[model samples]
Structure formats: C-alpha cells, structure tokens
Target chain A: MIKKGDTIPGIFSVLFGVLILAYIKTNEKMVVMSADTYGGIGPGFFPFVCAVALVICGVLLVLRGIKQNGNVDYFQLTPERKENLKSVVMLAALVFIMLLAWKVSKMFFLCLPIYVFAVNKLLKRSWLFTILFTVGMTLFIYLLFRVGFHIRFRP
Target chain B: MSFELLMSAFLDLLTPSVFLYMSIGIILGTAIGALPGLSATMGVALVTPITFWLDKVDGFAMLMGLWNSAVFAGGITAILINTPGTPASITQAWDGYPMYKRGEGGLALGINVIFSFVGGMISILLLILLAQPIADFTIKFGPAEYALVALFGMTMMIAVSNGKVVKGLMLGFLGLGLSTVGLDPVTGLKRFTFGNMGLQSGIAFIPVMIGLLGLGEVFYQMYDYNKKRAAEELEARKINQSLGRVIPTGKEMKKWMPRNIIVGLAATVIGAIPAAGGDISAIICWGNSKRFSKDGENYGHGSAEGLSVSSTANNGVIGGAMCTMLTLGIPGDAVTAVLLGSLMMYGMTPGHTMFTEQLDFTAQIMVLMVLANILFLIIGLATAKISAKLLNMSQPTVWAAVGVLCIVGSYCISNSYMDVIIMFIMGILGFFLKIYDFPSGPLVLGLLLGGMIEKNVRTALIISQGDWGYFVQRPISLVLLILIGASFLFPVVQGILKKKKAPAAE
Candidate 1:
C-alpha cells in the first residue's frame, strides 16, 4: 500500500543529492572551504549543505511513503486516469513537434497557426471552429508580437 | 511624500495609454477570475512576460489592475455557481450561492463589488502609511538580518504547503539548490554549468514560473476535466440567472459596514504575513465574523453580511501583500513572487532602495493601486450581470490557449528556445507536483528568494570572518530566528492540540 508518489520523489532526491556530491568531489576547484578564500568558505558550501539536507529529507519521505496507506495507488491506472495520461502525452507531443518544426524551418508564423490547428483538433473541436480559432489566435499573436513589439521571428 | 513627486506620479499614470493598459488588465482579470479553473496567480504569471515589452508604468498599471480585479471578480463565479473562481473566493461561496438561490444574486453581487473596493482602498491607505516606516527600519539591517529575513520568508512554505511541511521544505531546498547552478557568489567559480552558455547565467525565473503556474495548472485541469466528464458531472446545472437589484440600500450598508471594516483590517494584518494571501485571510475573517455576529445563525444559509466580510477580506490582502513585497523584498504569496521577479526584470531591486532611489516609481505604483481599485469597482459593478457568460467558455479552449501562451511566452523571453524546453520540463514536473498535492507556492517562493538567501548568508559569513555566530549575535537576526522557530512550531502545536481536542469532542 506504499504510495509511489511519495517514494519516487524521495528516491529522485536521494539520487540527485548523491549526484551533486559525486560531481563536487570530482572537481577539486569546487571546495566548501579554502585557506586563501576571504570567508574561508568556498562556492560549494551552500550547495553541499542543500545536498545533505535533500538526502536527509528524502530518507524521511521514503519512510513516510512506506508507512502511509494512501487512497490512490500510483501504480494502478484507472481507465479515466489512463485517458488523462494520454491527453497529457498528446499535448506534450504537440508542443515538441511544434518546437522541432520551428527549429527546422525557422518559420514561426507558419508553424504557429498549424500548431494551434493541431491542438484544437486534439481537443475535439469542430473542424470549422478549429480553423477559425487557429486563424484568430495566430493573427492576434502576430499583431501583438510582430507588429506591436516589432519582434522578428526570423533572422 | 512631497507634492511635486506626488503630482509627477499622478501625471505619469493619468496618461491615456496607462489607463488603456489598466482597462485591458481589468477586463482580462474579470474574465479570468470569473472562470472556475483559472486563477489570478496564473493570469498574472501568464501576463508578466508580455509586460516586459511595455514601459514600466504601463506594465505595472496592467498588473496592479489585473491583480486587484481578479481577486474581486472571483466573487462573480462564487455567487453564480457554488464553485469558486479562485481559491480566494472559497468563503464567498458559503453565503453568496445560497443568497443567489434565494434570488438575491444581484444583492450578493452588489455587496461583493462595494465591500471589495472598500477593503482594497483601506489596505492601500495602510500601505501608504506603513510601508515607509518599515522600509526605514529595515534599511539599517546587516547582511545577517537580511539573510534571516529570506530564511523567514522560506519558512512560509510550510504555511502555504497546506499541511505538507516536509514536502514543502524538500521542494524549497530543491529550489535553493537549483539556484546555485550558475556562478558562485563569493568566488567567481562556476558550480553546475556543464559548460553551456545558458547555464552560465543560470535557470531563468520567468520561464520556470510560466511553466509551473501556467502549464502546470492547465495539465492538471485537463486531467480533472477528464475525470469530471467521466463521472458525468459536467452536465450544466439549472440555476436562477435573473439578478434583482444591483445595489444594497444605505441602511443595509450601514448595518454591515462596521463588521466589514473590522474584517478588512484583520485580513490586512494576515495578508502582511508571508505566504498568507487572500484565500487564507478570507477564511479566517469569515469564520471569525460568523463567530462574533448577532446573525451568526444565518451565516452559511444566506447572510449578506457574511458575503460582505468574505468579499472584503479577499481584496483587502492586496495592499498588505504589496507593502511587504515593496518594503521588505518578501513576497506574501505566489503572485507577489512573480511581481518581485518582474521588478527585478525592470532593473529595479526592492526593499530600502525602493523608498530612496526608486521612490518615484514606488509612488507611481501607490497611485496606480488606488486607481486600479477604483477602475475595477466601476467596471465590476457595470459588468456583474454579464459575468455569468464567462463561465460558458469551453474548458478545452482555455487549456489550449494557456498552453500556447506558456510555450510562446517563455520563448519571448530573450527569444531562447532553451527557455521553452526548460518550461516544458518544468511543466511536467509541476504537473507531478500538483498530482501529488504539493503546493507550488513554496517552490516558487524558494526559487525567487533562493539567491537572496544564499547571497546574504554568504556575505554575512564573509563579514563575520566565517563565524556562524554572526546570525545569533545580531539582534534583528536573533529575533527573526526566534520568529522562524515559532512559525515552524506553531503548526505542530496546533495539530497536537487539535488531535487532543478531537477525541474529547467526539
């Protein structure tokens, strides 16, 4: 009955803290204290303290995660929750595709409207309304960013 | 406080362009605040990046107008529907919806608009009177005291986290740790930059803010929308939309005015506390007013006085929050955290300098705050009837629009694609944080104040020749540490007392 929600962040923090500790150890320049330093404390001191605190807190979270019997089991995906997950994945994919398209073409004006159109379609809007919305939103963004701010999308 | 400077500020804000921006912000705030899923903090976060392109006065006028009106407009949905438009309006729903059920929708709406304005103006007057004294006192603070102030601000994470103190502290520490990704403050040595040019300057605050507040909320709403739709609870409710009289009689107003003034003053005090914003203030005020009122029996059923107190308290926090942020460089809540970041973007630092070097700008802001409340009062009253139409906006449309804005807004900050990617990553992380019931406010406060806390602490260390005793040796720092300890311990003691009282009550 352990909550995956609590456990995952706990483990993540512990690993993250360990990673920081490992990275700082490999770099001699990132010392917590140096004899020649003005304050006798080096750049790594604050982050080092944070890392240790993170590890300690992470351990506490893991213990709490194991002890608490939460209502929702993160590992078990209900049908509606699955649909919710899919919608988010689709949304993230849409944005990623827009970014990739903009990178390849550098034509934000063209890419933006198409991105909007795709998003509206994903949201299950009528085709006609989606087209109109895409056009209206694109023009609004264009007029605001391009005409008003005079920001050039392309070099 | 001089006449010339005051007149200059008035002249600056009296321009048509400034008024226009303020009007647009008011309009947007009304729509945003009347919608169930959207929040004032999210609206402010979304608009903040766009404001960077405008003049300081125009930009702040828009922000001030948006913030004040959004808090006020939340009552629109609270009265019309049982659901609150924003967290601040939660208490508004108690008496407001029931009053609407009794066909007093217009009266409830009227009370909300009038009392919110009154509360907002009262808080503004307090801000004007008190901010200078606080700033002058804090001007003499040493680095240790300043560091303690930042630490004290971070402890607000516990308050905002809504009983998840450990998780809040963890995320706060995560923010503080992430803040050290760039150059070391004391030494010029770089810490976590894997040699990327972007990492040299560190993670940008705006993009992360936009991601967490904007995209994060959208994603969660999408998920929640799906759940609601699945449950078939999306069916439109049939309620009386007919609004009766729009204004209360003078006799009625006189009856409620004293109680409302007391509640507004109390809310102002609560709002000045770090992390205690409109939502918390309103709840405290509403509960306390009910406990003391002669008509306490009618509180939840349908008391106009209760609605007035709730409405007054929520907007009353604005002036108090601004006072803290402007004078102490501490954000009372998420919106002010974003505002603090925006101020930094404008090449202005808050705190003592805001009164000295930036006094003109500060005066302009004060004038704008007063102007914003007046503007919203006129507009909110005029548009109260039409506000119900705002709730009809499609959830999908809002989600898509907010999502695009989040992506584009982050990119608009220096036209960096890297920022967009960072925003996306943070969006996913923020979604998870929300799913797990973690409060994003503390995370944001930590991110915004992390550098201040670290920089001040290190500087104090240097001043004390690396002696840790410096913090305790200073009177102000010692006092702040005691306050911090009390802040953490109070909740624990309260929880223990509640546990002890529960069994006895049962």
Candidate 2:
C-alpha cells in the first residue's frame, strides 16, 4: 500500500544511489579490478554493490509509496508545527553562523558568545540571564578546552 | 593469581595519592559521562597526556577509575534525558528514560550503578582468572571471523528497528554507503570524497553519533513541545522533587542478578574480540536479555532489567578488553588501544610473557580495576539522587546547554570545524528520520561496523584467492556464520510461534 510521507525520502534515496553510481562510472580512479593485491575485487566492488542495493530498496519504497491511497501535502504545517520548525530553524541558524564565522575569520572565540547569547535568547531567557549565561559558557569553554586540556584552536 | 602479588598491588593502590587520583578520576569521569558529546574513549584519550607526568601506579589507577566510572555514569544521563551520554549507553536510553518518565528514576539509577559494579567486578575476575584462555580463543579470529563478527553486530539492526524493518534496513544501508565515502582501505583510492580534503577520511563517527542521538533529541523535544505538555512536566517534577528509594528491593536484585551476570559474561567475550567495543556489547546483551527475559514486553518501555543489562554490558567490556591487550598484545577496542600505547610507554610489552615477566604490574592492573569499580559504585549510589536533580532544570535550559555542548564536543574531537558542519547536517537528518518514524540505531551501528566489515571481508577474500568458501572452512568463522543466521531468523521464528499460540488460545 502507498504510504503517506514516504515519497520524498524514497526519491532522495534513489537519487543518492544514482549519484554514487554515476560518480563511480565517471571517476577513472574507481577501479573494479587490480592485480596489486590478493583480493581480486578492487575498491569499486563494495561501493558498487552498496549502490545497487540502495537503488533496489529505494525502488521498493517508491513503489510502496505510489500504491498508498492517501497522501497529504508534505509542507502543510499547523500552528504547533510552525512553532516547532521556527525553533529548529533558529537553533540551526545560530550554529551555522558560528561555523561560518570560524571559517571566515578564524576567531571561534569571538563568535562563541554571540552564538550562546543568541541561543539563550531564542530559548526565551531574560536578557540579563542570557548575557550572563553566554559569558559564563564562553569562559567555561575557554577554561575547559584551551586552558585545562591544552587544545590549540588555531586554524 | 599470586596472593603476595595481589596483596602488593592492593597495598600500592591503597596509597593516599593513588587513591586520591582514582577518586578524582571517578568524579571527573562522571561529569564526562553526563555530558552528551563527551565519551569514555575521549576522556581516556584526553587524560592520557596527563598520565605521562605521573607514576605508573597513579597514572594507571586514574585511567582505570575514569574508564570504569565513565561507563557507569553514562546511565545517569540516559535516565535523566532520552539521550545516551556515550555510544555504549545507547540502550540505556531505551529503558532508563522511560523508567524516569514513570517516576522510577531513582530505582533506575540504582540498578544502573549496582549492575555496572557487578559487571565490572565479574569482568575483572574473569580477566584475572581466565585471561590466557580468553585471549587464546580470540587470537584465533582471522579476517573472515572478524568480518563475520561485524555481520553478527549488524543483525541487531532488525531487533532495534522498533518494528519498522524496511525503514531500518534502508537507514542501515545508507549508513554503510556513507561510511564508504572516504579513501578505500584496500586500494587507497577515494570513492565518494567529491575532491573534498575533509571527505578523504570518511564521515567521523563521534560527530555523527552526537548529532543523531544528542542534538536529535533536542530537536525532537522542540518539535513535540507544547505549553500544556510543558506545564504537565513541570507539575510532575514538582510533585516528584524527592527521589524515591535509590536501592532496589532485595527480591528485585535477586531476580535480575543472574541475568546481569550472564550478560556480563557475554559482554566479556564480545569485548575480547578485537574491534568490538562496549557499544556492541551493550546492544547485543540488551537485545538478547529482552528476547529471553520474562519482562520482554516491558523492555523498551521501562524495564529495569534492560537498563541494568546495558549498563553492565558496557562496563563488563573493560576487563575483557584488557584481557586481550595483556595476553595477545592486541588492542581489543579503542580505549584499550590507547591503553596499549600507555603500556608501551611504561617500557612494558604485551604478550604471554606479560603474565609471567610482568606479574606484579599485571596484578596491579587487575587490582586497580576492582578498586575503580568499588570507588565508582559508592560514588554513584551516594550521588544517584543528586544526579537525578538534572530533571528539575527548565527544559529550555537543558536545550540551550546541550545544543552548545554538542557543537563544542564535535569541534574538540579533532579541532576541526568540518566536524561541526557534519554534525549539523546529521542533526537535521536525524530530526527528519525521527519525524519519518525511522530508527537511528541501525544507521549508527552500520556506520560503526562498515569499515571493519569491508576491510576484513576484502582481506579474507584476498587471502583465500577470492574463494568465498574459505569463510566456512574455519571453525570460528563457521560458528559465527551460524550465529549470524540465527540472529536474523530467531525473531521471525519467535513471532510465528507467538502467532500460533495466540490462535490456539483464542
């Protein structure tokens, strides 16, 4: 029977499998045979097998999805769902900004408090509490990793 | 086994400085285990550098205490939150969290500590008494056998799928595929790196695990949060401010002790197998105990015995892992692998000679393990109630804290920002997987075991000149193959029998 919410994941799986298979075909380094070692099967054999199996499973999932009678819009969201999505997006955005800052400026310590304060604020903490918590958290990380553990954070 | 050596080792460990170091390790390890992204392995690794500055007895004792205590304390967080503190404590979340939800948090923590103590002591005893035999047995495992061991681990995917077999298999294969992204172990050729330098080393395990189990839980809480539910939780916490009996009744212990002992023994065996670690042991022991336990129906829902089995299995591996390291000069798991380096740094080589030539040192290690277990048991029991206070914190506080911890922990693994990116992606994937009713355990297991399986399988095939029949020819491989078959089939058979009995009863 066709199942609701199965179509997208199934399609994603199929596309993923196809992408791997296509990569193997185009990459000259993806060798299927080599006389170098004892195992006759080369590096490509295992991935090839995995990709084929994945594709088969994806096809089965797609078939099952199609056979289902009921379907709903995947993007439809209730108020609660919308709220939940907002929280997830907010948290993810803060994390992304922290990483992006590290990648660009190599000043992870500078972005640490910003990320922490933003998250605390997102969680609806009082402004004073968020500011203090952010400072305390940043200090804790610095002391724990940089000072105690002797971790060098140079890029 | 010499009384004089044992006495000497015990006396050495009794020294104030050594004991103080071990106590510090216990407290430090508890904190490490309670933190979502910090694991026993990482803790041990981080402390290894510090150990270099200390005397051998003091250093080894600290490591022993930290390792055992860390494994024991993972159950604390698993009970408090629905996330495992370490991968080894994953099964603990299945039952311990549910038990906490049902207000048996105190008892769950008690069982977690008690059984962890029992398991650790039994494993050390086995290490002391049967190290040679166990090592001898495991050392015979060739490439085919190792491959089969990995396969055997994967069979648990079915049991862990939460009855969604297709989704589980799909995720499991996806993990396997993802694992193949790095350089090909056999040929040194990259498969799926897409020319990215970071992709050259496969997806990092800890980051993905932290994302899936730790951050994913946070997202799930956010997704399911509602004001009414939050209010209800707050009310419940207020009413349950005091932790009820932290000790199990005598009868409860009597019933679960035997099962815990069996799981401990099984975990010891699994741990002695190279490449298998506490996570594998815990999963196998927890799954098997559920299948055979009379309280099987209540396993994932909040069975005390299930939590005990998981807690015990994870720590029980310590001694077994040491057995292999001491007797065969082979690292049984990653922690032992680090210990192996430490052992060599002390001008000691592991092998059969270690039992005789380094008899005093060996006895010291065994004694250290016992003392570590006892130390943590006392600390864990005394603090069980206090640790449960974590549940009283506001949900948002935990959410923000865990989110930041996840990022910091992932970044610390190798000081790589790429790991953070990987964790973020996996966190989103994990959230989606949960929404779609997909089980994440199988995926984790697959990724954990994929490299081992592929490397061993290829090595075995090459050794056999591509004759697959060579796998069945070895006794160990043959037995493992049978076990693998049985692991997959037993559930089906059990289901069929249950159906038959249901009809008859009707």
Candidate 3:
C-alpha cells in the first residue's frame, strides 16, 4: 500500500546508500584488519550492514511506489505541494545567504539583524517592532553569550 | 534521597538567576499555551537553544518550568473563549466552555488551575520515588541486552508514528545510518569523515537536533501560509480574554481531591507508555471518571468534575514521561524526546548512571519539577489576565524570531560554522520529511540510540566470538529479544486486522 511519494524518499535513500557503500569499499580505514582473529568485525561492517538494509528497503519502497502509482495519478501538484516547495526554496535562499555571510565575511553579528529582520519584514511585521526586535535580540544574544557566558562570536 | 540533598536541591532553585529563568520560562510557556496556534512543544523547542549558554541545572529548571506552565496555560483560552489553546486542552473546551457560557467560567478556570497543580505535584512525587528503582533494574543490563533495548525502542517508533509506520521506519533507519558517519565506535577507525576535520568527531547531533525540530518546524509552518493567514484572522477575533477568579476555594479543591488522586495515578502510568501523549491521558482519565460523577450526563456540560479529571491527568503525564526518560533512556513522549537530547548535551546519559553518580542532579530535577508546578500556579495566576496578550504579537513576528534563533543557536553550539552549514542542510531535509508526513520523534530517538546499539552489538559479538546465539544465551537478553520481536510483530498483525476491518466496513 505504499503511495507514489513513498518512492521519492526511497530513491534518495537508495542513491545515498549506494554512495556510502562505494565510499566504504574505496576507503582504506574501513578495511578489515586481522581477519584471522575471532570477532574481528571491522569499522565498515556496521555501516555496510546499514547500507544493505537501506538499499533493500529502498528497492522495496520503489517497487511499492511503482505498483501503487498505477492505481492513482501520483504527480499532481496540489496547492499544498506548491506551497511546500515554495517554503523550502525561500528558506534555502535565506540559509544560503546566512551561510555565505558566516563563511565569506564572518560578519555573523552584522548579518544577524538583517537576516532576522528581513524574515520578519517578509512576514509583514511592523517595521519598528521588527527593527527593535532585531537590534534588541542581537545585543541580548551577544551579551548573553559573549559577556554573560564567555563564549565568543565570530568576527 | 537524603533529606539534606533534597533540601539542597530546593535551595539550588532559590538562586536569583535560576529563579529568574524559571519565571521567564513560566511566562513564556503561559503565553505560548494561551495562543491557539502556538504550542508547548514549539515553545520548548524554540527556547531550548537559549539555555545552551546557561549552567546545566539552570537550563533544566527553566525547561521543566516552561514545560509545566505551558501545559497549564492551554486551558485558559478554553474557559474564556471556547477554544483550547493546545491540543491537550481540547477536553477543557468540553466542560470549561460550557461553564463559561453559564457565567461560571471563573469557577471552571479556578478548578483547572488547582487540579492541574495537584496533578503535576503527584506526578513529580511518583517520578522521584520510581526513577531510582527503574534505574536500579536497568543497571544490570549488558551490551546484548542494550542492543535489544534499542531495537525495542525502534519498534516503538511504529507505535508512536500516528499510522505512518512505514515512513517512521524509513526515517528511523536513515537516522541510524547517519549516526555511523564518524569513527566506528568499535574499531576506532574512520568510516565516513569525508575528509572534513569536523566530521571526525561526528556530525554534532545537537546541531542536527536543532535543525530538525527548530528550523525544520519554521519551514513547515511557512509552507501553508494561506491556512496560517486564515487562522491568524480567527485568532484576532477571539480576543475576549479576561481572568475572573484564578484560585479555587478549599472546599471545591477538597471535593475533587479524591477523584484527582485516582486520575493522577492513572495518567502517570499511561504517560510512561510511549505514544500515549498528554491529550490521550486527559481523554482516558476524563472518560474513566464519567462513571463516578453524580451528574454523569452533564459530564461535558459545565461539569467541574470533568475539568478536574482532564487538567489533572495531562499534567500527571509530566512525571511519568520524565521517569521513563531519566530511568530508561527512552523518551516518554515528544517533549521528553527533546529532554533526552538535553540530557545528552549536559553529558548525562539517561540511565542507571544518573542514579549511581549524578543522583544529586537527578534529585534536583525531581524537586525542580515540583517547584515548576508551584511557580507556574503562582506566576500563571498573577499574570492570568495579561498572559492572553501574548497573542497580540503577530504570527509572522514570532516565526521570524524563531528563524533567527535557529540559525544563531546552530552556530553557538561549538562555535563552528561547519555545524551551521550542517544544521541548515538538515533543516531543509527535515522540512521535506515534515511535508511528507514523517514523524521527527523517531528520527531523534534513533539518532540517540544508534551509537549505543552499534557499540553494544559489536561488543556483544566480540565477547561471544561472533556467535548469533549470544544475544539469547542470557536470560535478560532473551527477554529483551522476545520483547523486540513482539513489538515488531504487533504492528504487522494490527495492520492485517485493520485491513480486514476496512473490507468488512466497505
């Protein structure tokens, strides 16, 4: 009774599992050492098992999804689906910017207020409260960590 | 526990900073609970990271306080405006709203606050008394037994998955696979560091947790913006919030005391069971109490007895949930799942070690839970009228603040930008998981237990020279294995029965 969407996550799982298995095979550290010894399960053994399980489940899921897909149209882009996609896309952009600010410039503090306030702005909060919240929160977090807790932030 | 240690734990809560944080948590919990869309889980999840910088004891005190008060706050709207602020408070609407319609809203609300306090108190007492014995029992467990214990936990994900057992298994296994990304626990060999220095220590689970529960929820919340808009409009209209009488008379309290005791005990037992959330505890308790009530037919119609049972049982869940989380290393419910993560962050594994070594801290948690209920009553009643103003803050504003906190909190842990990147990626992954209707509880539980399971399996294998029979040779391990098989089998059998039922219904 697996639906069509069930296969989508399963496909990703299959791809991920394959990549891990490939890496396990190629990696030097994962090799079984002292095979003559009793109970000498190597580091890769557990992950190897996990990968096999993943692949098996993935294949089962994909087959189930395919069989189920025949009974019902599974690719319909309902409004809820569109909204879900849009939410992820917008969040991704915000995250990418936040990451770049952290990595490229290390301006976590500067990016902090803008990133937070901008999301609020997008959500249609009053400009003044959003700004106040941004500034107040930035200072509070800064002092709470850097001053109160002695944890330093990135420059 | 020694009287001195118990007293010391009480004294620990008296510190100005700890008291302040507890007050803040109660205030926040009340606000979150009073708002229809906001929930205690979201309040706890959002506020969890802020406690990262606080001392461990302070952090738990704040969290426990928040947990208690947020739950109590949900009934406020039910009595005042015929709406339950949290799902657990839906029972409040049945009796409380009816009373409000009859101008006995004050009496109903007062009953709610008093009974909730009693329920929370009883639960903490049970948690305090039972946690040590449970830990003592689990202390004798071996690696093979632990492996079975973890397998048993994974099976529980099916029970708790809210009918999406397949998706639960898929994500739970995914979490286990992801947990193996660092050095192998058995061989000390790197498995999936992927050449990144940060990956050697393993994916910081705290960041992954924040990503999934915190930022992940924000993304999902934003997904159905249109629905949220309509909900917000409805919220704006339901602003007839005012507290009339916030405390119950002694005679009224005495009247419900006997029934409250019965409901409270039942609630704790039910809460100890995985997948039985606060809502279920309230429902079951209320349903059971119907036979004992004099006005049984008026059970849902302004019956103070109805308010008493529901309020008591929901809070009673807190103690049972904590006991399981602390003593068994298994989360009692979703919030305790996060609480389990918090225990990990504080370097305290939720098992026998807590009793043998961190017994004082364990005792402190028990005492603090009791105190949280007391303070929640005090602060909640004091601000009962004003706490409703919490919804005055717009939804978008709250979401925006949560978004910022998620990013910042991810970065604050270990001060690693790489963790931030990891968190962001996981946040996106978590969003999809949510959109597709997968449970986050199992994934988090799986991640917590994955390493334990792997280490135990390997150790057990090494001890018995890779004999598959080793897992069942010991009595404890045999019992655990049987339990594991039963757990996995139960769902499949239940599914078959359900299929048969569906066909007959058609």
Candidate 4:
C-alpha cells in the first residue's frame, strides 16, 4: 500500500516550485540596491535569492519522489479515506461560523457555545455535559478577555 | 547595570498585577496543553495580544508562565491517552500510554511532573548564568553564518518529517520562499505582493501557524470519523474500569531518579542551542535513554524510565529556548520568535545590551519561568487523574471541540473575516498534507525562521560590504557552519557505519 505522506511532499514540491517561479517572474522589476550607510539591503535581493533556492530545492525533491517506487499507493485517496473528509468540512464550517459571528455581531458569544455543542453532539456525549462545557468555556473566555482584560471583540 | 537599578527592576516585576497575570497564564497554559493538538506556541501566540496594554515585565512574565507550563502539560494528555498532545510529547507516548493502560497512569503523570520541573529549573539556571556569554559569542555571526544556521535547522526537518528527507526539505524551502512575499527590508519595495495590500506584510505567522498546526490536524482527524464508529461500538462493549490510585512509590522514584537527571541535563544542553527546540530534545533524550537502558526490552512497554526521560527533556527546552531569545535575540522556536517580536515591538531589542538596559524585565521573565515550572507541576499532579478521563470521551465530540477551537483561534488572531477564510483554506491544505505524510513541523519552522534568515543574511552582507569571508572569519560562525554540515551528514554517515558494523557483528 502506498503511504499518503510520500505523495503529499511530491505534490507540495511541484506546487511550491511553480509558485516560486511565478513570484520571481511577476516581481522581476524588483532589484537589490547596493549597500549604503545606515544599514539596509535592497528588498529584491533577498527575495530573489530565496526564490531561486526554493525552486532548486523543490526540483530536487520532485526528482527524488519520481525515483522512489515502494508503497506509493499510500498517498492515494480511496473511498475509505473519504470519511476523513468530514474533518475538513467541519473545520471550514466552523471558520465560516466564526467569521459570520464576528462580522454580524461582536457579541456573538453564541459562536463558541454553538461550536462546543456541535462537537459534543458529534462525539456522542451527553447533552448535559455538552451544555455545561459550552457554557463553562464561553463564560471563561468572556470573563477572562472581556471582563478582566477589558478587550472589545470587534467584528 | 547599577545595583539600585537592578533592585528597582526586580521590584517592578513583583507587582500584584504581574503575579496575577502569571497565575492566569499557568492555569490557561496547563488547560491548553492537556488538550491534544493545542501546543504551547499556539497558547502563547493566542494570548500574547492581551498583554499589549500591560507593562513590559508583566507582559513578559505572563508569556513566560504560559510557555513554561504548556511544555510540561503537553505530556499529561500523552500519558493519559495514547494520543500525544504535542509533537514533543510523542516520544513520551511510546512508553507513557502503555503505563496508563497498565493502570499506572497516576504514577507516570507524577514522575513526568516532577522531572519536568527539575529539568526546567536546571535549564533556567543555565540560561541566567550563560546567556550573556552565549550572546557575546553569537554576535560574531555574519550572513553566511545565518545561512548555516538556517541550513542546520532545515536538516532537523528530516528528523521531524518521519522518514522523508526530500519532502521535508521541499516544505522548508517552500516556507523560506513564502517569507519573501512581503516588502523587502533593504529597498522597501514589494517582491511578491501581487497587487494585494494584505501580502505587503507577508504571510502572517500567527494565521499560518493556526492553519497548519491547529486546523490541519483537525482535518486529518476527520478521516478517522467512520473508523471512529467501530471504535465507539468497541468502547460500548468494553467494561469501563477505573484507573487505580495514581501516585508513584519511593522505590519507583529511586529507580528512575538518576536516569531522569542525566537525561534532563543532556536535554537541557541540547535545547539551549539556538534553533533546537523541545521536540528535538525530547526525541533525542528518549532515544539515548533507550540505548543506555539496563532493560532495553522494557522500553515501549510501561517503563517509568522512558516516560521520565522524554517529559523532562521536552520541558527543559522552554527555559533553554528563552535564554537564547533574551540574550542573543535568536529565538529557538516559533513561539519564542513571536515573543522576540513582542519584545522588539516594546522597544526592547534583545542582545548583550539588553542585560545592561533592561535588567529588571529580563530577571522578571526568568523568575516567572522558574515559578511557572513549579506551579505547572502542582497543577499537573492535581489535575492528571481528572484530565485522564478525557481519553474516554467520544471521538466525534473531540473533533467538534477541536473544530470550534480552530475557528475561534484563527478568528481571534486578527478578528478579520479574511483571516478566517485564510485559516480554513490552510487548514484544508494542512489536512491533505498530513494525510500524504508531509510533516507540517518543518514547514512551520521554515516559515518561522525564514524572515530571520533572509534579513540577517542581507544585513550581515550589507555590513561586510559584500564580503562573503566575513562569516568564515568569525570563530562562532565557523563553528556553526561545521555543526550544520555535521547535522546533515552525520545521519547518513551513521547509517552507513551501522550497516557495515552489522555484517561484522554477524
């Protein structure tokens, strides 16, 4: 069976290389200025060098990936692996909820509790415990940040 | 440098508000560390903004408290559950979880706490006494030396990548490239902004960190959801048994103390080196302890010696990392890098000069670390038994909680909608990466150190009038270069030697 890890790096290396090349091409006008008094190097110099290094390293990685032959199937996305997809969706939805809460009302203290509740329900935990945890966490955050520190949670 | 000034500085750090904040930090730190996937770095980064309005020493103390406590608490989850709380605690799980399964969870936790405290205290003393001298030595580094340091750090990525060297290097380079996306420091011109104003500041470390480490793991956890059903069914069928009394006996303590102290000292020294972190120290110490074990076969079983060595080494890195950050402006890991940024933001540049200029703030942070370590032991021992119950919680519920925290943490970083979006996308990417066996640790480390490496290299070159020889001319830089070369080559060399020796032994 192919391992998922080997394939991930191969894809990342290729994507990283493309990104580096694109960055260099788009920012070609930027150039390093000769060093002067008061201590500063031109902005373009470091980026250019860094980009080239990335491209080189990335290429070497891709080549190595191609040469490796054993258990490459580990990286494959099978139906069995599809179940793991829920984590991604749930995480994305949570981020969306948080953003909506932040934007809609800074006082959306509902956001945290809803999140905690959803998790508790998913974990097949008792409603009582979930509610208690949600309330406890929300109150803790509210007291600590808003009441104690006087921080405003602006949208 | 004056005695009166030092006294005043010490007095300032002892204020009631500072103590309160430190206490709060320890409590929060332990809570977060006890949770799997919530790390010290995340806790500190998330809480750092709260200190913006406080005096510098108070702010520093709160951060120190969190950093010190979080490192120790990470092992609590690992010991109780088979799940490692942080990457640093993974080694602890090799033996700790087995002990927990054998109904020795309490003893394992107690030993872990005591050794963690001892390790942290020793490292802090080392920091207080040796930081200035180390700083003086580090000042000699030039651009080439920084490049070497980055190189050395990159090599460690292979170790963290879990047997994939190429992928680790690729991720590291990718991170370095990402660091170049903002305005260049020398010319003040944009490099890879692509016309977006947000890119002007480069990828925000806080958001990227949250996405990669926090959200990414959540995504990976989702894959196990179905299998979780089987696990739940199995759990239902199994009888729930209470763990017996959880304290270590004197005989057990006597058996493990000498090994713990030796491993702790070794780990402290390793962690104190710039660029090396707790994860590396813990893993190394664990490996060394196993090699030196009288009953090596007992390892990966419920060996108290195994748990003690790993936890002590991991916690030891906190104080050691801080020493480098305070004295040399060189952060040992991502969290300290953020702390370093906070220090600079407060107009306190760390270096040999910081000792003379901000004696009290420095002393206060050190003292806070020492106190926090003691407090963490107390808190950890008290809460270990209760927290272990979390291991029995349903997987779905754990995921739900993690998902919520991930979103909340990302949003809290900037309170911006765009940041949440970024976090979501990054989290998805991180999930895919994890599934494919790509190590996020190297990538995070790369991004964390990328800016430092670039800016320092450019600055050193600028100062040297473009003389590459400047790095080699310094003794410290030369030593660092050799070390970097050894870090990269030693593994390969050792593998070869091991192979050759195997035939001879046979």
Per-prediction DockQ, in order?
0.61, 0.56, 0.50, 0.44
| Each candidate's interface RMSD | 2.1, 2.4, 2.7, 3.7
* Tens digits of lDDT, candidate 3, B360-410: 898888888888898887776666555555656555666776777777777
Question: What are the clash counts of all predictions, listed in order?
Answer: 0, 3, 0, 17
The number of the candidate with the highest DockQ is 1
Q: Give lDDT per model, in order.
A: 0.85, 0.78, 0.77, 0.69
Instruction: Give the TM-score (vs. native) of candidate 4.
Output: 0.82
lDDT digits (tens) for residues B397-474 of candidate 2 = 767877877787777766777777888898888888877777775676577667777898999998899888999999
Task: Give the runs in model 1 whose Cα sits over 4 Å from its true position.
Answer: A1-5, A69-76, B2-4, B227-240
Q: TM-score for the first chain of model 4?
A: 0.71
- Per-residue CA lDDT of model 4 for B392-425, tens digit only, reads 4444555565565555555554455455566677
lDDT over C-alpha atoms for residue B423 of model 2:
82
Tell me, per candidate, how large a share of the native contacts it keeps: 0.58, 0.65, 0.51, 0.59
**TM-score (all chains, Cα) for each model:** 0.97, 0.75, 0.91, 0.82
Model 2 deviation from the true structure expressed as Cα RMSD, one decimal place: 6.5
Deviating ranges (above 4 Å) for candidate 2: A1-3, A33-38, A71-78, B1-116, B127-132, B240-369, B494-506
Cand. 4: chain B TM-score: 0.83
Candidate that would win on TM-score:
1
Quote the positional error of residue B266 for candidate 1 in Å.
Answer: 1.2
